[model samples]
Target: METMHKGSAGLVSAPSLREQARKVIRGLVITGQMQPDQLYSVPRLAAELGVSATPVREALLDLEREGLLEAERNRGFRVVSLSLNELNDIFAVRLLLEVPSVGDIAQGGLSDRQLDELHQLAEATRQTADTGNLIAFLDTDLKFHVQLIATLGNQYLAKLVETLRDRVRLQGFASGESPRDFLKQSANEHFKLLDYIAKQDRSGAEATIRRHLERSRGVWGSRHNTTQAAKASVLDESS
Candidate 1:
């Protein structure tokens, strides 16, 4: 009986640790702290996270299932790199899903309490962006969007959108703009969305979300260009 009780406790606590490891590692991946194409061993990551290898390994498997990482035989996991075409495809699907859904939400309208909660989340994203807290901004921004979509009560849609968002690489800010400014501008769009929803303006909400998604593509694309340019310059110097 005691053995069974201990086993039950292990089942509960194991998942808790695994989830904690998953969130931290996911944040690192999304925020570009974990570079693409690099093999990350479970032991090293577990030591860095101060957890046992079991939970870290489990967390890594979860990320692999999410398409953020790929398992390598006899090695570890590698962050998956998305091509520009893949990035564009993701945004395209997001537009088709999110724009219409947000419009529906705006027409349906949110309760005052829900709006208040959303506003708080929006403010959190803005604060993180303004302060150049990339990790925090990503976390808050994700929460804001996910919470907004949750109002529609479509669990699958919400989860799909979240997965798509996670797959995009935010390695750097757009060229010719300060990181803080670029992030702040994007963060402020959350408020515009909320305002439109509050007024039950379906068209306004749709436009705002569409523009927001397009702007994100532009931001990430510009950074991709900059990275390529830098690589070219390095090769030129070496050659």
Candidate 2:
């Protein structure tokens, strides 16, 4: 009476369904479980997730707004194909807006507990990288900076920067190398940033943040060659 799946053998966690759905869909898009540059069918995703299409559609739309997906010509949506130029530009904007925010973090100053937690987080990032856990590495990588900036008490700035955080994410995930390598580099930067902030070295923190964003820009920019993009970048492409 019902269509059966070969993977029906796998267990499904149904209680926290929406959150689970979002995680699956985000990973598919981010890690290229789904083809990039192609329209992603919500019905197909729903079937794969063993739920109705509603949550998948909702997640796709949310990612679309986040710049990971785009409204298609007739209907449905496609993963937004970012040009190397576009990705670089987005990071450039991030650097411009976020570098200055470090000053606020330095001035706001961390309590002893916050300082200890940041050190612990920084170490965790390094350990995750060494263990070659790229996905976990990315999760903490984003959490650290977002958490760091949120520490500034500038909610507006934090929210604005997050509005396009996915751009860098998509590129780096599609990037052939493990995100652990980047996270490894970033974990070290976190210590440097904290060291500056702890000393209230406002200018040094801002400069370090800018330099960090700049170096990352250079790496992503390398993948821009249309020829290189075809080989190096595309996460998925169902032919």
Query: Candidate 1: where are CA atoms >4 Å away?
Result: 1-15, 170-178, 231-239
Give the CA lDDT, 0 to 100, for residue 200 in model 1.
100
Which 10 residues in a row give candidate 2 its minimum summed lDDT?
A: 1-10
Tens-digit lDDT track of model 1 for 135-214 = 67888988899999999999999999898888775353322324787688888999999999999999999999999999
What's model 1's overall lDDT?
0.80
* Clash pairs detected, candidate 1: none
Ten contiguous residues with the weakest lDDT in model 1: 1-10
Whole-model lDDT per candidate = 0.80, 0.69
Tell me each candidate's RMSD, in Å, in order. 7.8, 5.2
Candidate 2 per-residue C-alpha lDDT over 1-239 given as tens digits, one digit per residue, 9 for 90 to 100? 12223232122767666666665665555554444545656676677677877766777777777777776755667666677677867887897788878877887678888888888878888888888766566567666777787787777877777665656656444535665666678779989999999998899989888888877676556544543557654555643
**Candidate 1 TM-score over all chains jointly:** 0.86
Against the hidden reference, what TM-scores do the models get?
0.86, 0.80
